[model samples]
Target chain A: MLGDCRDWHDVSVIEVQELTKTFGTVRAVDGVSFTARPGEVTGFLGPNGAGKTTTLRMMLGLVAPTSGRALINGRRYVDLERPVVEVGAALEATGFNPGRSARDHLRVACTAAGLPTRRADEALETTGLKEAADRRVLGFSLGMRQRLALAEAILGEPRVLILDEPANGLDPAGIRWLRDFLRHLADIGCTVLVSSHVLAEVEQVADHVVIVARGRVLRDAPLAELVRGGELKVGTRQPEQLRRALEEAGATVRFEDDRLWVSGVDAEQVGRAALDAGAVLTELVEERSGLEHVFLELTRAEMGEAG
Target chain B: MIRLIQAELLKIRSTRMWLGMLGLSVGFALMGLVFYIALAGVEMDGREALPPVTDPDTVRAFYANASGGVLFMMILGIVGITGEYRHGTITQAFLVTPRRGRVLAAKLVSYFLFGLAFGLVTVLATVAVALPALAIRGGSTSLLDNDVPMILGGTVLAMGLYALVGLGLGALIRNQIAAILVAIGWVQLVEAIVTVALPQVGQWLPAGAVRAITRTTGGFGGMGELDTLPPWGGTLVLVGYGLVFAVIAMVTAVRRDIG
Candidate 1:
């Protein structure tokens, strides 16, 4: 299964072109499309149950897409010769055998990918799991398992990395290390795609963010754009009045759940309008117009649209 | 393919399973030797070890019982593939290879080799332990003279086929516990019941075919009479069973989503 695949030719872009996966009557992933570019860390972010894992599974060819393709380097994941060397995917924490040692688990990956077994040792050391390298995974903590999974992913020294929730069970220090590690990989020209539901986690590490909701891409752009787009959340009994007042104040207002989502303006202006209108306030909080706001608002919009 | 098989072998090397299995084969062979030696002089009224002292049947039975150890080899193959799904390592395996067929093929090859080793170990251990007893009993322990080589060779062949059957079953049944239970249950209970109810059909079953191949009646003593196909015919039947398992397993593997 090796030696015949075409050389990738600087084409380490991960493209999910209209990927759709339906289970029974439900569409777990509905036409989700996003591209992860080379030499950058792309965050595939979405709220829980928004098809993040399903999309990752599809990208790795573990789950077949009902319609569409997830291509990396101009090829499906299964088409690549020595795919582990070219595209490393760690999609689940439940992938390793608990009875096997960390080194053994990584060695299996190394062997399967036709890489030298020494790569397992190298990966263990790189992931800071050298101390527990010989220990059975049945005794390892969640953090250790994640690290071991990471070690396996890098066992082949792949050019592209796709990790699903790599930071899900890490300590703060571990998470910080992972963020820096991904940054380092991207700096070295590896295409890195990391998925997480926590916007704050990906916010620090991702150069590009593909915010998804209900199996659809909501925002796909540079992280900088989402950072500057803050939302001034105004909660009041007279939501309609606040929505009109905020709009009249030249703010882009979206009325939802009896709350006024005033964008393109600060909370101070929205607060003043509520004050003058004599609308009783329940809550008025200024949320930074970052990934979190986009994630929440987009998910809420999806809920409303579905309703 | 060689690399894949190497990886599969490495997976077992890190665990205590291989050592445990090897020890079990030796233990079974030792037990068989002891059982034969102890029972050689037993009688309801203290009768002699008769049935003609040098008829070769006693030694043949003693060696053929070692084939009983190959059941572990079958379980080894079953656990080799099903253990991946049982422990959720198939996810990692599929990720590393991305070609389920290769993973399956690698397992078939690796487990077949392991099973053969198991058979060799058991038979050699039986011979090692039995030779001293035979010498003590004033009988010549000539392995080449009594069709011992043919019997042992046939046992090894059966071991490989059994492992293939185990691999195929494991593939067809992704649940390890369920597969193991079904494999054993079908042999011990289902087939036993069927054989009692329909003797001819039962003799054609895979277990019966294995018995035919090894020239041993299914029991602890390796002594009984039952209808069986010719040695080669039984082998073909067993091989057919293995192939059926492989075909079904590969088809299901391609269609089923990796959990």
Candidate 2:
């Protein structure tokens, strides 16, 4: 995507340059590059083994990169004088002692950043964990734990937040709450980079998307741009007949299973063509491309090209 | 660095395991007193006991022998560090601090302080409980009168070093069982055999160095075969061992990818 060369007018919260991580002979994170900016939630989309976690870890300086660099707020994470104040991350919800109280856990994080201890209680309140604040984390449900982790991340009021699978264990209500919460954080001009396997959730929350597969970035663009790149699907019952008509009418046509897939023509045009050709239109549904379909297509296309 | 240390201390205080370990430390200390009382009784009767101890040095040696109960302290140390890895809490810690070395330093400091405190409390409790019985048998003696600072300092040093070792093992292996196995095996088996088979070389091993520094050496009985090093030399070696392992652990942790 040449993300590095493209000058993003907005403030860039995170920037990666040819980020590569090789574990022995395995290239866990290949030459992947992307930038996430403030006032927007950037979705780091990747399937399992796609190196999303590795990239995030590298960004946080938890894992060193074999090549390239990850810069946060125009400086390397390790170089930051106050890291917690600069960047707050929740890489995994399991990153807490189960026997410790949620309040104590967050208080420790606050102390690490030199923040006031009262921020721990405030974070718990923000994450709706005030009732369970004093309770041991061992008894928390997955959703509660996720919230607690989020609470810890925001305790510092950091300029940037990096979370991996933040919605993994949330219920529908919890997911909605998180979506709104992240959007509000971005609204207040905080940069948020969230990695998730759930395409739907990402689509719901992210303004920008970075799709990755097999240690490579397949696409890095605005959500609208990605959705607009794919051809829209228009369905009709006149299979063979419609294929011939579409080609005659200057539309690209392909056959899949028992249906005719038409491109290069609007859904209305196709319907008009079928009507003009005396074909009974049993079905005429215009399918807008979704992030899921775009993601699958890009990943599958990358796999096919690689193979 | 101070902030990280404070945070780690808070985590330690909030854990049930810490409270449990405190309880265990008290229990072991009381047990040490009971054993000391029994030994005093045998000494009063002038009966030829196992190993035949009758002097105050021997009595101090006997009480020193009971310090082996500090294994509970070791367990506490293991849980203190390894628990984070097991529960995946270390990621949050790293995310907050990012400076892996600083995070480790905080853990080492916090764990050492906790171990020191526990060791002091236990030693005082044991002396308090066992004094009456020792007095009846004419064996009671104050710690201050009998190199108490040396003894207490040695005990605290041993406990603190073991705790640091626990933290290192936790970071190196990351698995609770593996860390515990390595810790127990390092103290009970590997170090023991090496100290016996290679007395000169054994002086450098952590546990051996701890014994040497502590000065009261009848606990292992025949296993205390190696001539002890000077107390300062032993302390230096123990501290050096802790730094080496702690540095390795921190470096490895910061470099490795989290799951």
lDDT of each: 0.80, 0.77
In model 1, pairs of residues that clash are A230-A289
Which candidate number would show the highest lDDT if scored against the true structure?
1
lDDT of 1 by residue, B85-201 (tens): 877788887877888888888887788788788888777888887888788876658888666776788778777777888887888887788888988888779877776676578
Local lDDT at A190 for model 2: 79
| Model 2: per-residue Cα lDDT over A142-221, one tens digit each | 99999998898888888799998999899999999999999998887778999998898889889999999989999999
User: Residue A207 in candidate 1 has what lDDT?
Assistant: 89
| Candidate 2: residue A101 Cα off by (Å) | 1.7
lDDT of 1 by residue, A154-227 (tens): 88888899999999889999999999999999887788999998877899989899988788888899898877
**Model 2 spans with C-alpha error above 4 angstroms:** A1-9, A229-261, A265-282, B41-47, B50-54, B194-204, B219-226, B230-233, B243-259
Give model 1's DockQ, 2 decimals.
0.69
TM-score of the B chain in each candidate versus the native B chain: 0.89, 0.85
Q: Assign candidate 2 its CAPRI class.
A: medium
